[model samples]
Structures are given as C-alpha cells and as structure tokens.
Target: MTHRRKTLLRAIAPVAALTLALTACGSDDGDDSGDKKNDKSSSESSDTSGSDDGDDATDEPTEEAPANTGDLPLGQAASEEKEIKRGDGTLKAKITADKVDTGENADLTAAGFSADKVKGKYPVYAYFTYEITEQTGEISPGTDLNSTTAVLDAEGKPGSRFIAIGGQPLKGGCPEKDRELEWKKGTKATLCTTFLMDEGKEPTKLAYGMVNPLLWAVK
Candidate 1:
C-alpha cells in the first residue's frame, strides 16, 4: 500500500477509539452537562474528519499530459465552463479551455474531456472538441480555417471504447450521420450519459455536452 493509504488507515483506528471512548463516557450517570458537552464535541470532531475523508477520496491524481495536444486548439478567442459525466464508475466532468493559444498562430485551447470510463477493466477515456474555423482553400486547419467543431473518434485512435449515448454527434467526422445539431454554432447542449461502471445500479458517469451546435439543442 502507498504511504498515504497506510496513514489514512492508521488514522481511522485512532478516530474510532476516541469516538467510542467519549461516547461511553457520556453514557455514564448524571453528570448531564459533561455528557452533553462530550457528545457535542464528538459530533463536531467527526464532522471535521468526515470532510477530510471525503476530500481525500475525491481528490484525483495527476496523469500524463495529452499526446499531440495543442496548448490551444480553437480559433479566434473564447472561454467556456461546463460540466459533463464521465469515468468508469460514475463521475461528473468539469471542462474548461481557452479558445486561443497564448502565442501560437494555429493553436487554440479547445474544450475537451479527461475521463476514465471504459468497458473493460481500468479503462480511461479522454478527448477534445474543436469548433473548427471551417477552412476554405488549401488553408485547411491543416492549412488554416479556425477548425470550428472539428470531429470525434477522429480515426478511432484510442478507439470508441466509450460511446456517448445522449449527446448529439460531433461535427467533423461524420457530420450528423447520427443526429443534426440544434442550430449552427454558439449553442448549448446537455448530454445525460449513464456510464456502466460495474454490475451496479446507477450509471458511472454523467456530463453536459456543448458541441455540434447544429445538432445539440437546449432541450
């Protein structure tokens, strides 16, 4: 086990002991005030400790940076904050990115996903969305055109290990081969996806999607 795990376990025993001891002391006869005070103190302590435990469990570890990633993968300039569902066992994904790179001509900070939702064991899913500039000539985003809402499963690189059930189809790849966007560009959409983590009840992940404005609608 990691040192951090060991420390958490060690702390648990002491917390339990302290709680039991105080609880027992409070149960003893008529020193009513003392008992009440002990109970109050115990409850407060537990609450604080509970918060710490929750923080520890929810804290995600750092992972490797994206491969072939652009500091910014959007064009013009924009910033958005949204939430989505993802992960192997049900989790909300908070996504945020800049529309333009700090100082790179063809680089834009595109909105994307960093997830761990997969079919098999210990699988991870992460991807980015580009609202492309919609190039005209040899100026392909490969040349030039902001690359507005580019595509998804670009060549199934990592593979469609995770399928998006509720969200509309991403633009670039097969442009609405699945469903059309709500409008054209600059629209918002919500995606209610149920991630299948284990043989459990609730879905593993849930997230809102803002892509292919042409397909995704406010509904």
Candidate 2:
C-alpha cells in the first residue's frame, strides 16, 4: 500500500505542474494583447490632434482690401487706348485720356467760377478723346464721353467738381457740350472734364469708372 501511494503522488504532481504552466502562458498572452490595444489607442489620439491644427490655419482674415479682379482690369497708362462697353452695354467706345492739366486755380476763377469757389482748391483739366467703335443702339449727346471719368486725389478719393452745373463751356477752355444730338457708330470727338482737388495737393491718378477704377498715372 505505501509503494502504490508514492507512485500516485508523483503522477498527480506532474499533472498539477502542467496546469500551472498553461495558466501562466495564458496570462502573458492577455497582457500582450492589452498593451497592443493601448498602443493603437494612443496612435489614434495623436492623429486626431494633428488633424485639428491644420483646419485653423485657413480661417484667418486678410489685413487689406482685396484688389479688383473683375471683368475690367485696372492700372492702364494714360494715352493707351481701351475699348470698353458703355451706354448700358449698347456701345463699345474706344477711349484715351490724352492730356492732363493741373495747377489751374487762376484759370478756374477766370472761367466763370467765383473767387470764393476757386479759393482753397487746386483745379485739374483732363482731356479725353473717344470714338464710338460699335453701337447696337442710339447714343445721345447727354451721354458725353467724359461720363464715368474721375480724378483721384492723393488719398485715392475722387476729387470734387469746382462747378457742378453742366452744359456750358467755361471761359478757360474747359468745355461741356449740352447738346441733344444723336451719335452713331464711327463717331469720334474730344471732351474736357474738370475736378477741384484739395489745396496744396496734386492729382495722383486719372480714374475711369467710379468702382474699381482703371487707373492712369498723372504724368
């Protein structure tokens, strides 16, 4: 009976040792799987943070007003010819600001402008030559070639007119024709427009069109 019991104890001991080894291996595998899941979660969190930073860079505003990038481009030089569709897109006019005259206070006073009106103002005379290159409708004399033309002051603002009344030729050759004549295609003419600049300031640019004006350097 003692020999039989000793053999049985040895067998049971080996079986218990095998069971303990298998449990230890299972615990190691569980630890490895948990570490892999933690690593994957950390990598996903880092990727999300990087993506949020890129979205902030593109939402900033600009410091200055954007330039005109429209149907008509800006900054054409004086004496360069440009064909623009005017008169409600009924006529295509070929136009150029041929000459610019400045420092005309005395001339303004002589040209029927009151002394009080001419005082404290620098005057400008801009002569433009234009022709109706093409027209789909009738053009009136009231639609003068100098319409939509302006002189920009040093501050990029349009200069005010010394005299607002139209239709009369001023004494110093700044003529305004107030006729009711009709114009046809291929008709050409020259006209003068005037502006009253601020005292002690010179005209910086001749501008065509009130909004996003096509600028010509006053040379």
For model 1, the superposed segments whose C-alpha errors exceed 4 Å read 1-178, 201-219
Model 2: per-residue Cα lDDT over 114-177, one tens digit each:
4563466655666656676666634434444444455555554455533232112334545434
Supply the global lDDT for candidate 2.
Answer: 0.39
Instruction: Give the candidate number with the greatest TM-score.
Output: 2
lDDT of each residue in 109-133, candidate 1, tens digit only: 1101112222121112122233422
lDDT of 1 at 152: 20
lDDT of model 1 at residue 157?
15
Q: List the lowest-lDDT window of 10 residues for candidate 1.
A: 3-12
Instruction: Give me the overall lDDT of model 1.
Output: 0.18
